[model samples]
Target: MEINDLTPAEQQVWRAFATGAAVDFREEDDEDTAEGAQWGPERTVRATVLRALLLNGPQEPGEIAAVKLAGARITGVLDVRYGTSDFAIRLSHCHFDEVPLLYGARFRQLNLSNSVLPGLTAATLRVEGVLRLTDCRIRGPVRLGGAHIAGAIFMDRAELSAPDETVLELNHVTIGDDLWAPGLRAEGEVRLNGAEVAGSIRLNDARLDRPGRVVLDAETLTVHGDVLMRKVRTRGWIGLRGAHIGGCLELSYARLSNPGDAALRASSSSIGELWLRKGPPMEGDLNLRRAQIEVLVLEPEMLPTRVFLSDLAYTSLTPHVPAEHRLPMLERDGDGYVPYAYEQLATSYRRVGDDHAARMVQLAKQRRLRTTRAWYGRLWGYVQDATVGYGFRPLRAAVWLLSLLAIGSIAYALHHPHPLKASEAPHFNPVFYTLDLLLPVISFGQEEAFAPDGWYQYLAYALIITGWILATTVVTGVTRTVSRQ
Candidate 1:
């Protein structure tokens, strides 16, 4: 394109680039600094730089380095859709009246650091090099859906606001390297659903505030490296449901404040490790239903009262959390008890060499099952709990037996039953008589010798029945322990 063919605004930008007099916005502190800097006749480069670059091929390296359109007010849409370019477009410290549309555009690199834009719509855009927007302030939503970046997306210290809806959408995007956005402040949801990142997604020290809504929705996202969000403060939920993270998902020191709903939902997601320890107490449920995590580093006290852990499997739990602290976290669905929830907890306890804790978890499972059982089953479950602690506390059976013996002996002594054959009987001892009545298989000849009529006879029968129940419970508990070992 000739200089005469260029529009007036385009010619101004072309002259700036050709003469190497283009203002470097990066060196200037802000838009005011760029406006104050004297650059020949024009203080501001009022041109669509994207159009100028497409019309005239890639500029020289030295010229491109100094080709910053600082304090420029771009008039029309900078549409680079379906076009191919080999230039590193740097538009720092510029003010855009409209957002740069890069839909389906291919670029070598794109840098808009420290710029102020209405928003960005770069759906299906492909970049061969880094896409830097660090420290930029975007007032509207940023749509990067279906983008394929061979390098990182740097938005460190950026302030983005798109209230109520998604502020930054990176759905189905592929990033070769890290998405570095530390210290970012986003007012609305940041959706990364179905995105694939070869490196970590570092949002450390970022503040995502969308109360009562999802602040970070990364469902089905695949990250080869970690998702480091250490010290992040989110007012709403963080959904990582179905995400496959090769490395740890570290949310340490995070402050999440959505009490009515799940603050973190990672259901069916597979991750190497999950670190939630040393954080502010979570205000809402941390739903990890069916998530397969290798290692879970969480402090018991840091978790909220309501945590959905159904089918949530983990090989290790850090900080040595006791089963007592973890059992309450497996919330029941209505009145129905989740047996696998207890099983998972028991497995966790067993992994930590807490056999006693494992047994306690089993006891809790049986207790919960009792609540959902029929009347007869519930009665039997209660009996098992009281007699032997649902086969967990075998010593309880002995305690019950001793108490029954003492009561029976006291009753027999107080009644003072006469012997059937007073002269022929060997002795009339209440202790022996109670023992004879209590022992089902062993006959001490005291029951036949004694003649307890009316209420005492019925009491004797009750003692016999009690003895059988205790004996059966103790035997069943012993068998169960042996089988478990």
Candidate 2:
């Protein structure tokens, strides 16, 4: 890397590398323009010159050595694989002829803000400081798998377009700080599987467009801080299965669509707080099965046509509304007749001291349970529901008992029965006779001593059968209530 072989622009960049000075090549009015403009001799630097300076640069006394070039067309491959550099590389507003290959390389910091490139391949690379790609327009994949970044990676307003393939891959990476990538537009999958982020991953207003496929897959990703995706728009599945987020996962105002498939799947994940309200109805199913969330904030209208909530455990619910408003979502659970789902909602209601609402949830659970039972079991369930509300409505049982008592007493009062034993009969009172016939286990001497003939005898038989049904249903309801407690 002799200085005599360098172009005039390359010689100028070399002189400023040791002092960390930026070489601006664009005119004042064309500051916002790209590297496509034709420039003569002064605005072009070969990638070999930049790579050589990065590998071995002059040490300045108490001054940091950095390669900071702006608005220049970088030609050739800046291959630095398996190389180690202590200098910071800042190449803003530059256009690269080929993707810069930094695989398995270790550097202090790399900032390529407002640059246009075919792609970037920095897999297994280690950055001691931040990796900035803000406002970059990349046409190929940006692979960062197995990388370790000590500081944040900023990709604000960056556009990474690699259709039907992965645009950004950060799997198994360890980031010491946040992944701040707001306003990012990616045309393919953006994965962060098995990655551990010590700080939050903010992707607010980002649009990930990969229809009918998974656009964002962060499965098993562990984030120590919140994952905010407010106002974001995604056209495919966003999976977070087995992920653990120590703070809130807010997806408010996000429009997610992966019709007939799962729009968001967070199964087996553990999140501190999950918010899904204030958004339009999602087109696909929402699966939260086996997920444990501390505080779940959701609106009924936000629920999709199918939702899998089996075994989902949440300590609290937002809005603190009554059970009726929340019961509709349980009805939409794709895993039908999950008793735990209903019980979890009832438990959440009981925690807030809303016992009435809790009872309603329990009643709804029995009704849902009826749908999964056999014919005989369903028949019995219907009887119990109509009579006592499966013990959730104790007043309904009392009403049934009083109604039967009045019906039997009035029917027998209109017709008297002959005495079976004239000497043993105490009186001919219709109310006492009806009570003796209706009470299944108790007798008041009237039913044993008297005998009804013809139509009166049929009425007595009907009363006896109705009395047994009432007694059995009451006992069954009481037993169920005790067993649940």
Candidate 3:
């Protein structure tokens, strides 16, 4: 695009470019522009300047004067429609009258840092290089849906405000590198639903204000690297449901406050590790239902009141959280008493060689099953729980046996009886007789000689049943332990 063929606004931009004159359109004078002779004549660039620059492709950095269209009220839409250009466009400290529409446009690199714009609609847009919007203030929503970027999207220190909807929508977008937006302040949801990122999504120190709503919705997202949110604060929900993160999902030092609702919902997500230790206490539930994480780093005291862990699997629960604290988290599943939740915890304990903790979790699972079982099954379950702690605690059987022995011995001592045969020698020791009745395989001369009448016979039968139950429970518990090993 020649200068003569260009529009008036485009001609002025070309003149600045040809003369290497720095254009100034900012309302306020800064230190760099304090000297009037240092800057070129002030000119407000229209959208045509952007069009002419793109049409005339590939300018080296500083080849043209550093165009300062800051606070320039560019009228009409700066549409960069279906075309491929290798130019690196830098429109820093600029104010747009409308959103720059770049639907299906391809660029080598783009930088609009320290600018004030309505928003961006860059759907299906492709950028071969970095797209920097650092320190920019956006009033409306940014739609990067279905966009593909070969480089990073840097929005550090940016203030984005889009109420009642997604402030930064990157749904189904593919980013080759990191989306580094540290110190970002978003007034609404920042969604990356179904997006693919080859590198990390670093939102460290970012503040999202959307209470009770999803502040960061990255459902079904696939990140090759970590989702680093260290020291980030959000008033709303953070949904990573079905996201597959290759590196650790680090939320260390992050403050999430969404009471009653889920503060972080990673249901069905697969993470390399989940770090929630040494952080600000999460106010709401951390729902990890069906999530598969290799390592879960948590501080027990930092956990919220309710945590949904239904079918949530982890290889290790690090720093070895105690069973007392860990068990309570499993108990808060929405679907009460999820057996898989217990199983997952048991597996984690077993991995750490905490067999006792693993057994405790299994025992809790069996007890939970009893609550949902039929009446007859429930009766059996109760018996199992009481006798040997659902085949996990063998010591309970010994306690029951000792109690039964004492009861039977007391009953027999009160009423000593003679032998059934009158000729038989009276070897009527009540303790020996009680022991004889209690031990199924053992027989003492006292039992043979003495014959009890009335309720004593019923007492003998009760002792016999109790003895059998204790023996059976001990055998079952031992077998289960051996089989597990």
Candidate 4:
């Protein structure tokens, strides 16, 4: 474990490892406070540099290559700008502390993998070697393009920070191994365009912050591995415009808050969404285009909150679009996803005074399935509603009043307890006035009040009122239930 304990050959490899990773040949915009590394804070910045050479950077390859040397401590900047030494540097659980990298710093043929790399700064990097920072922090923008990393790369918990510039470019880099950057945090935009990962590329729980427009045009990029990004947070819209992914594109519980486009785009790619939340850059083919969520999709509204189907073809308005747009959504997705997407698109178009575009969706639906029931059902429901609205309860009161008068007339004729009173001085016939008229309203009350000779009109009056209430309740309940349904 001591720095000077390693043999002389191991010493050179350690020195080369330190030297190759230190000094840069290019100029950058941001000045760093990164100091040349040492073993520990107790050791001076000078002694640790020399001691690093003995542990892993051997002087001769014949000695270190022929034998196995392990547990190396590397200090200081190893400016390996095309350094000739091809050291394997394969040791698990080694510590990489405060190593300042060179500009255009290439990890070509060098392996400082499966180790702890904290407080590291590399501006422009080229991953030409098998790099493993499974739990490391390579803080800063990692612009590595056209660099062929020929071995498995592990960056599980790496933090990649970018310089303060308009764009942070990390495009077209090829990885020979599985590239993992799950839980990776980048202060600026992280671009991975034309990148090929031989193994799976996992980037779940990754955070990328870019104040301006950031493009991840990993189009034409091939990843032979399953692309995993679940619960990831990106401060900008993710662009995978024309990217070709060989395996499933997994994104679950991801939050994308870019003012421009969707948080993520697999538009031209085929993939999966076990649990996805895709909002947008106006309109693009999100995960809904390819896969289905085995679970649910959360908060699916984005930027403009609509997708336009200007490219859809139909029997009516959408007839202008190509037939491709009118086709069913991909087989594996949820049933209503595409229709909803189109629905959203139509809404957006309508807001901008595009009536024709709005009708395009309706026409497309008709072409897909012909049915008049929807329209008729609406009309039928409206008619029932009108019936209830137009019918007046006060009209029934008028009919009741007429019936009361008829009953009064009949009562006067039938009640002959007194003989013809026209000649009998109208015989104080007060019953003919109030009693007769009021009798019809209370048929039952009249019967109980007195014999046919008495004011039996009260019975009919009570019966009429009971009938009215019964009729009203029956009619009201029926109409109300129908309207609600």
Candidate 5:
């Protein structure tokens, strides 16, 4: 039925809604709540009609949330502006149209489930009951500023938006978003999982003070445009499990405190961040699987892992600890942050636990260290070859003869340690092992002359005889890391 088909009284309330006066109940002055909220008999009835129209919007405009309640049972959009009254509201199976709702109104108890209302918009919103908008299509900026929904407010699979220069602003509100209260304090679960937003949405400066099973589990809050959140803060675990955020997602001064495995997994999308502050679960994994991060953002010192891939782009690992500041949150109160942000990605498939991530991260670090040492290793190798070529040129023939004999003797000594005096000395016992391995190595000079038990003994004895030869040889072979610095 059309909105005009309602009763005479319903039409009056509907006209009030058109004029942004629906938030003011009946028997109330528009002057009292022109800019805010005022509760009268008419507002309560209108809240009922509003609930019905949103749940099942073929409702005549004023016939939905426009009702009267004598007991604590208040339903629909509880438009109790200023007067304080407690009521329990329950409306199931409803519909909605592009109707407007005033923002500043308080309710006692409200629930709209199994509804199909699209284009539900609100202005100075304030509710105090269990507000649930499940299976509803809200096609505009659903603003709820300075409102308190003490009961559970569920919006599962409900399409919400703030398009046409509008925004979904939930300024200062509290919900049991909790799942057990009364005819007064919304006593149930407040779930907004699997919701879609066509325009930018926000819970700017909204406080979610619940800790039971995800204070706010918005498992999939898809944003089809850029999300602007400047000074936002969350107190519970925010579940953005598989959220597809289009455009550059900016959360500059947002402080999210989800002590669960709710890492911002903005993978497979083009995204950007300003100043991000992230903390791990007091348990699970914090993942950034295949997401890209542009240079506009800097990793916070609180982010445990050094650097990670953001959108198929590999960046250098930068220390999150800035040289300027330090805070007391160095120690995590929970188990620990999952060490690897690389493996869970499409490029690297690692095991599920924290240990596996630790190993991969360590390996990457080791390779970096080794590369640094390579330059020093090259210097040492060059010097060692120069000295060997110059000093041994004179004794080439004799050295070669001695090395040949030493090879056979060392082999026999090692195989039959009982004889050949190999049992008396540890150095000669390993001589065969070295000769067997080194014989195949091709050298520039018949550096083959450098092998043999006698030469090996002479090198070992150099420490006592003069020390210069041994010092030069040992120092030339090894690159001291500290000295290089």
Candidate 6:
């Protein structure tokens, strides 16, 4: 690290580090900032010299001291593990021969924008300011697990590729500000599991292509602000299971396709709001089982072929439509006949003052329950549904009562039954007699005083049985309705 051993570019960078002057090494016509024509020894700087300059840079009295170099070919590994630096490091439009090792290092800010590197291993790295990787192309994985950043991390327009391995790993990372990575193209998995971000996670317009695998696994990640992934196109799974978001989780216009499996799994997550509208029908399953959201903004047509919505609760639904229209979405639940999902939908409808639609959802829930019941139970359910729609359609009960009354009156009026005793018998009234026959509990003494012959007796027996069944079913339906309320 002697002054005499410094290369031409290194000598310029070393002298300029005290005053925080940026050393540009690019030709005038070089348009490609990342990897232009190869620079000779004149533009090459040893990583050891850069590391030494960063750690032991002379402080200027009134000027900021920083290492700012551009378009240089860094020769060796920039190993600054466990090192502490008071100055910032900005290496733009450069190429690194080896991955920079910044493990457990502390810095004010780190900017590697428009640089082409093999990889980066900065686990447990502590940065007081922003970490910029904008427009860079990384050929290998970038690991930042357990890192603490006071400022935001920007990876806008960056292309990270690791093929079958993870491209970006941010597990257990704590960010004081946002992690902005819009227009990112990652060829492998991007994990953010157990990461806690004080600000939002913006990955809008990103393309994540890891076919038949997990493209993004952000399980148990906690975000204080929104996690905006609008228009993100992913070829594999994007999981956010058990994640807690303080603000909205917007996935509007996203196209996620992972056939025969869950394309987006947000089960057990809690979010302020979830916007999944303005997208095409997803190619795979959308699992939101047990997720809690304040507001759910979804387009019904955007639902995938299969969905798992058991116990998923949302206080409000956008587009404020009838529950009947939303009921079809519940029907697509992978776990068939989830009563909680139906109840949640019904509650959402009721919140919107759509009581009729809420009742319809409840009715649908009952019908779905029938499918899971025993044969006898289903038969009884059919009876209730046919008579009164399980208390949801009270008009059906009135219609049934009127129809039965007419049939009974017509049958008895055709032929009067003989009286058991002449003294006890009243005048022959068909309507009163039919009423007595239909009303199993309250009788007008007609059924007790008279006895019918042959077919007439059988008809009377049938009426009595039908009357008792209708009474029992009506009571049951009414009890169910009252208990739910």
Candidate lDDT (C-alpha), each: 0.81, 0.90, 0.81, 0.46, 0.39, 0.90
TM-score per candidate, in order?
Answer: 0.86, 0.96, 0.86, 0.47, 0.38, 0.95
Model 3's alpha-carbon lDDT is 0.81
For candidate 6, the lDDT comes to 0.90
Among these predictions, the greatest TM-score belongs to 2
- Order of the predicted models by TM-score, top scorer first: 2, 6, 1, 3, 4, 5
User: Every model's Cα RMSD, please?
Assistant: 3.8, 1.6, 4.3, 16.8, 16.3, 1.8
lDDT of 5 by residue, 6-93 (tens): 5544555445433233322223322221222233333223455545433333333444333222111122443333433233344344
Q: Kindly report which residue stretches of model 4 are placed more than 4 angstroms away from their true locations once superposed.
A: 1-76, 90-129, 163-170, 215-217, 270-304, 308-485
lDDT of 2 by residue, 1-485 (tens): 88889889999999999888889886763564354445556788888888889999776898888999888888889899999999999998888888999999999999999988889999999999999999999999999999999999999999999987889999999999999999999999999999999999999999999999999999999999999999999999999999999999999998999998999999999999999989999989999999999999998878899999988999998878878899999999888888999999999888888999989999999999998899999998999899888888878877876787788778778877888878777788888888887778888788888888998889889888877877788888799778867
lDDT at residue 341 of model 1 (Cα atoms):
79
| lDDT at position 198, candidate 1 | 99
How far does residue 466 in candidate 4 sit from its true spot (Å)?
Answer: 45
Candidate 6 residue-wise lDDT, 351-375, digit = tens: 8788899899999999999999999
| Cα shift from native, residue 244, model 1 (Å) | 0.7
lDDT of 3 at 95: 67
In angstroms, how far off is 437's CA in candidate 6?
1.3
Indicate the residue-level lDDT of 147 in model 6. 98
Candidate 1 Cα outliers beyond 4 Å, as residue runs:
1-22, 25-41, 46-50, 58-71, 331-336, 406-436, 442-456
Collision count of model 6: 0
What is residue 236's positional error in candidate 6, in angstroms? Answer: 1.3
Q: What's the C-alpha lDDT at position 299 in model 5?
A: 46
